[model samples]
Target: MRLLILGTGGMANAHAKNFSAIDGVEVVGGVDVDPSRVEAFNAMHNIPHGFGSLDAALNWGEFDAIANVTPDSVHHPTTMAALAAGKHVFCEKPLATDYARAIEMTEAAEAAGVVAMVNLTYRNVAQLQKARELVQAGELGKVKHFEASYLQSWLVSKAWGDWRTESQWLWRLSKKHGSNGTLGDIGIHILDFAVYGAGSDIDKVFCRLETFNKAEGDRIGEYDLDANDSFAMTAQLENGALGVVHATRWATGHFNELRLRVYGERGSVEVQHRHDWSKLFTCLGDDAETGKWTETEVPSVPTNYERFFEAVQMGRTLEPSFRHATSLQRVLDLSMLTDRDRREHEVYL
Candidate 1:
């Protein structure tokens, strides 16, 4: 299996390195609008061919897969073009800046009959993998409640000066460019991994959105700060489990933390991020009340790139497929509507 990376951003290196490490997979080329960035990326990663534009990569046509790690706004166009060119796609999360475009992208991939996977990075967390396995194996019985949060302090521009001065984060706060803001960036991942761990889909959402302290005039450049800094929602799953979901870049003490806990009839499981990694805990049996939580050692698992290559080789749909992404987008779309009316919205998939 051969691949073409779609961007020269920070994540493109990880993609190139991880795929290149696989025995049968090769990263044949890379595409980026900036020729100098492309040059640097190739120099750093040894990607044999680099293209100034995606069209160039499409014309070269030597790869069977696309690692679509481009910006939020351009995901739809890049993934669609690659899919149309008869390549499988591994897209970065928040499938598109807009929900409608996300739907269209998934539909196109399905119609093209290619395996598709969204890089919901949280799903790759070792502890979360254990949580997912526990949920599926009934070690956690029928889940009754779920709670998750992803918090970060990057937007605490005081420590790093104004992030609005940086090119990397400027567009991320734009309503048109960033779309749902922190919700799309970090919130979607919480919802994704929560749904994955719970072994069900969310059916409704009642949400609160905040753009509070991060104001439009507070930025350095002529930037758009229309996106939210935080979002919290109460969600109901298809399995009758209730949950709370939260994501923010404003939590003062948290550098970056994502935590998830699920309670079921027979057991309960929890996972927490620590220093960019994770820890898993499980409480089972009648000892649940009296016994201390036992830390479950998470086993090793394949990287998203490895899974993508495996799916391509096996001719099967990948886990956390484009279909799942559309459902997650449904939750986000309805959450926006819920915020508007201050009412619960059905997540109609």
Candidate 2:
């Protein structure tokens, strides 16, 4: 498969690495707005065709797929153009900044009869899949509660300096980029994973999103700031399972800590990140307290990015299908759309 990667950001770099290693796939070209970025991508990956604008890649005739790894602000435009031009598209997550555009993008893909995939990479985690399988096989019985969190300290202190200083968190904070802050970033990931692992859809959500700190002066550039750094939500799934999802960029100690736990009638399972220790532990029901936890040791499966190309080659379903991606976006929209006064409204079963 010949692919055109449309960004030279960090995520794009990761995608390039994976695509380069895939047996039948070739990253034919790349496009980035910055000349330095495009040049760097071509230099590092040895890609033959490098263009300074997405328009060049869109007009290029040799590419079979377009990877829209650009920033959140331009995802819709790039993906739509790629789909309209008869190229299959694989977009980074939070497909578009908002729900309506996300719907439009998917509809256009369907209308054009092109394959579209969203990069919800966490779903491809092998241990998470094992958790899903265990739930479905009744090993965990009736799921009662689900909790997942993505905690990162990357934005904990603006004084220490970070990539965010380049732009006053506008890409994540502005309405033009879709929803504000964590709801669109880390929150959406956990929401999708929760629904995927639980095999259910969220019927309703009650969220409390906040921005505790603001850019003090003019150092963080100039942008209309109306986004949150943290969000906590309680969701009621269609399957009678309750869930809590919390995502924050302000956590002090955790650096990209992602953890998930599910409690069910027969047992419970938990997963913790960055630990060489047994990643999954299940507590099956028993009368006595004699070490009821089942220690399921999971060997890390190979990363899922390359598998995406393999699936594309075989015409198989992508891990988080495009429809699933849309559903995840819907949950995000509903949560973030709640009025400020009702951000913490309760949903009773």
Candidate 3:
């Protein structure tokens, strides 16, 4: 498979590495709005073609698929363009800035009859996949409660600024670019994982969001910190499950910790996805007297990019489907309103 990468960001680099790792895949070219970024990626990967504009690369028409790693704001247009051009597309998370746009992108892909996938990388984790299987197979019967939290300390420090401080990373802060803040970034991942792992679809969501840390005095970023840094939500699922999702960039000791727990009639499962170590723990059955909890070990495995590529190649539905992705975006879009509603001591769902 020949691929064209649409952005030269860190996530784009990760995607390139994964595709390059596959034997039959070739990264034919890359395009970035920044000429320097395009040149750097070209030099780093020894890519055959590099263009400073996506339009130019699209006109080249040398790739079978387009990796739309552009910011969330442009995801819709970029993916639509790829689909209209009859190329398969793989986009980064939060499919589009909003649910409507995501729906439009999905419609375009469907109309064009091309494969489209969102890079919700966690869906590819083997342990998480196993958890989903167990839940689906009734190993964890009738999931009743679910919760997920993704914590990162990067925004807790003063040195956390990167592309987020520039217009280059549009939508990283502004709701217009997408839904404002952490909800769009890491929160969507947690929500997607929770809903997917529990084998359910969220029917309703009530959330509260906060922007405790802004780009104020002595801060480390250039753009206005107009987005939330933390959020919490309660959701009702289609499978009669109740769930909560919490995400924050302020946890001091937590650096990229994505944790999930689900409780059901038969058993409960917990997942810890972190660097240095990752594990899955299980508690089977309930005890009143001895209060015993059975612990089943979950083995650590390799990263998820490989599975994403295979799914796309095989033309199968990957976890965190566009339908699920759109639901997550809706929750994020609603969270912005929750922030304002709570300030007035009002609850909004």
Best by TM-score: 1
lDDT score, candidate 3, position 2: 89
* Residue-level lDDT for 132 in candidate 3: 78
For model 3, how big is the CA root-mean-square deviation?
3.6
Candidate 1 has a TM-score of 0.95
Q: Give all candidates' CA lDDT scores.
A: 0.85, 0.76, 0.75
lDDT of 1: 0.85
Model 1: per-residue lDDT, tens digit, 184-279?
888788898788888889988999998865654745466668788899999999999999999988888788788999999989999998455689
Question: Could you tell me every candidate's TM-score relative to the true structure?
Answer: 0.95, 0.90, 0.88
Better-scoring candidate (lDDT), 1 or 2 = 1
Considering lDDT, which of the candidate structures 1 and 3 is the better prediction for this target? Answer: 1
Error of 1 at 44 (Å): 0.5
| Residue 77 accuracy (lDDT) in model 1 | 86
Worst 10 residues of 2 by lDDT: 340-349
